[model samples]
Target chain A: MLEAISDWLQSTWLSHAFISQGLWAWPMSESLHFMGLCLLVGSVGLIDLRMLGMARGISVAALHKLVPFGVGGYLVNVLTGSLFVIGDADQYIFNDAFRVKMLFMLIAGLNVLFFYSSAFQKTKLLGPDDSMPLNVKIMAGVSLTCWIVIISAGRLITFYRP
Target chain B: MEALFIWIETSPLSLWVRGESGWHMAFPIIIVFHALGMGFLVGVALAINGRVLGLAPQVPLGKLRQFLPVAMLALVVNVISGILLLIGYPTKALTNPVFYIKLLCIALALWNLRWFSYSVLTNPIYDHGVLPQKTRQLATASIVLWASAIIAGRLLAYTYNNMMSI
Candidate 1:
């Protein structure tokens, strides 16, 4: 069944059209994807740093406003990234580097959900001039590490052309 | 102009970077780290800068400092990883004007970031210290700089004259 799925994807018109068109389309999507990446990194970096005590003057809730922009970045990347898959679904689906990248992305996505569900709810301590709880700190640390790994994996995908 | 390009491309390191060897493996790994480093570094910077400029006022300023180490550490990683990537493809980046633009944007953004971090954003006077009106300008610039840098970096792949041209 899985082999059939791969064969179908390789033989599909969508893949041929996209790949042919992607000479230009690929670069454009890549550009937008990078832009989105910057947004996610920028917003997440600020909040995570704030949580860690680097910028002692910014409020936690205030920093949280940047999350929407981060989400916006993520959305842009997903939309543009799909183009690549549609263009060559089999190439990426079977690629080990691609698989690793997807794994990191999934982990990062889950980490964000975990953050909102648990850390976002602990708002009492998010007050002005209060110390962050250890759990929140841990979350921040994990989020930062996970994001780094995800980006690394994404770049690796290009090199690992299986 | 062709001679200069050739000179760069012929450099021992440049030849090694593109040559099919360990770089085949190293290139992708380093690129991944570079991307991640950018995300962490910029992500932290944007979030902190956004709040400092008063985008989100509910969270306290002091409490947000917990994430700085991550950004700083990521920056360090990028610096190391970026250098490796650069060494891997010295001519590809050196010959490209867009690459220089990306680097310049990053430098200015980081410069502006340093100024904002030390001055208006961290002033101890406001409640958890509200950011000064002036700092917002820096934050805006930071956003622009990073956005441009990322775009320019991506263009490097498309814009550069590849081995076929050489």
Candidate 2:
């Protein structure tokens, strides 16, 4: 069951060390989390906006160069987020907000997948100022909405604690 | 100042912000706004700083200016939501030294944003991504100041001496 996994995660050395780091640990991780969020949003959101036809005269190929930063940010969040759950598994596993947040993250991930697989070829070929096709724009919208919901759900986690 | 804190803390709107009739919606929603705004504002700033430091050179620096408006919009949203949250717990925030540090960092960060806007973003000279030395330095400072602001803001919850009219 989920409880067993939570127990096992908490028993791990990483979680033990994380929790033992005293009061500042949580805030420090949170600060890092916020920074990582900036990186992800800044890079990924830029691409989305470009695909949505907001920042014209910028080629998708050029803006896509920032993908590494977004990936880096995503990794940072995953690691820090794991620490949160590992350090206090019960805080997240049974939490509806956390569940919702995870769902949003999954959707965002899938949205990106679908884009690169289907839309990226056509969109990337478009000129600097050319508008994206309607389908591509829909994906861009979905990406933005998913991220917004993910953020809101994250904020709601503490409040929605069960 | 103490009286002002007390008054702000007791206002009907402030009470609602803290939460009302078990709604508990206002505070968390405001915080979400704060988070979303921070993501865009700080995130876009980071991207710009990266470009100045030679991260993404193909994108014309001037073309990047279009994104600044979104960051500005984020700033506006945060300012409004931040005020709402402050009104909710004036004593908790105002009485804290870290709060002032956060404010200072934000002010300086905004100053850096303005400098970057005029000096680098608006200047067609750097359009090809070849930034001046000073512009690069300012971009570095922007990153540091923003990180400091976020750190100071995060630390506020732990560093505050008084939660309310103690």
Candidate 3:
């Protein structure tokens, strides 16, 4: 089933462009991917650290404003990530490291949903020095760990490629 | 130069780093750390850069100082890992012009951060409003340099003339 999906995705125009766009495409997208990684990690880390009780002088609500940039980074990475998987699906779908990366990303995604559904309002009301609720701290901790694992696994993809 | 590159590449530590000897996981581990270090180092700097550009107007500029320690520690990680990587492939990085550009951009970006540190961050009176023109310029320049540095670093893999001397 996975192989079939990979084949179908590879037949798409997106994969065609990614495969034939000359030498510049891969490096260019990789650069943008790295840039997006930095932007997303930085903004999200700032908020996470703050929620977990570091950077106690910055208000949660104020820092939340930076989420837009993180969202932008997420969009850039999704686009670039799609290009990679679409162009060379077997390289990712059959790679354990890539699978782990996707798993970690899924965990991170679920954490995002949990935050908005359960903690967003209370988080917004948090003052700079207020003690974070245990669950919120858990969310932040999970997020930080997931991102670290996701990045590590993503880097290992090349080494583990099929 | 050739002799120097060969010397470093054949060193025991480099061999270990390159997975030619010792535990084979070292190279991947080093690069993994490098990426994590980048996430913290560049990430925090970009956050600070965003702050300076008035993205989070209510946050005290000095408050951002709380995050610098993590970035500093990450910088240390990158330096150590970067040196190890360079040792493992001196010819690859040294022969590539993009590598030098990346280094220069990083140096200037750090210099830009220092300028922001002393001028804007330390000023207790200026946390919330429009900062001085020069201060904004520093952040803008830091942002540009950081983006360029990352792009150049990525390009090094594609542009290198030699993988190693030996």
lDDT of 3: 0.90
Across A1-162, the per-residue lDDT of candidate 3 in tens digits comes to 998999999999989989899799999999899889999888887899898999887889988888899999989999999999999998999999999999999999999999999999988997878879999999999999998998899889989978
Write one digit per residue (lDDT tens) for candidate 1, span B8-29.
Answer: 5566655555654444555555
Alpha-carbon RMSD to native, per candidate: 4.0, 1.3, 0.9
Model 1, position A128, has a per-residue lDDT of 50
DockQ of each: 0.57, 0.87, 0.90
Clashes of 2: 0
Residue A100: error of model 2 in Å?
Answer: 0.5
How much of the true A–B contact set does each candidate keep? Answer: 0.91, 0.87, 0.94
lDDT of 2 by residue, B1-166 (tens): 8888888878888888889635678888889999999999998899888888888788888888899989999999999999999988899898888999999999999998888888778888787846778888888998999999999988987898888872
lDDT of 1 by residue, A36-68 (tens): 887887777566765765666555676667778
Candidate 1 positional error at B28, Å: 2.2
Identify the candidate with maximal DockQ: 3
lDDT of 1: 0.72
Task: Please give, as one word, the docking class of candidate 2.
Answer: high
For model 3, what is the error of residue A41's alpha carbon versus the real structure, in angstroms, after optimal superposition? 1.4
The residue pairs that clash in candidate 2, if any, are none
Where does candidate 3 stray beyond 4 Å?
A: none
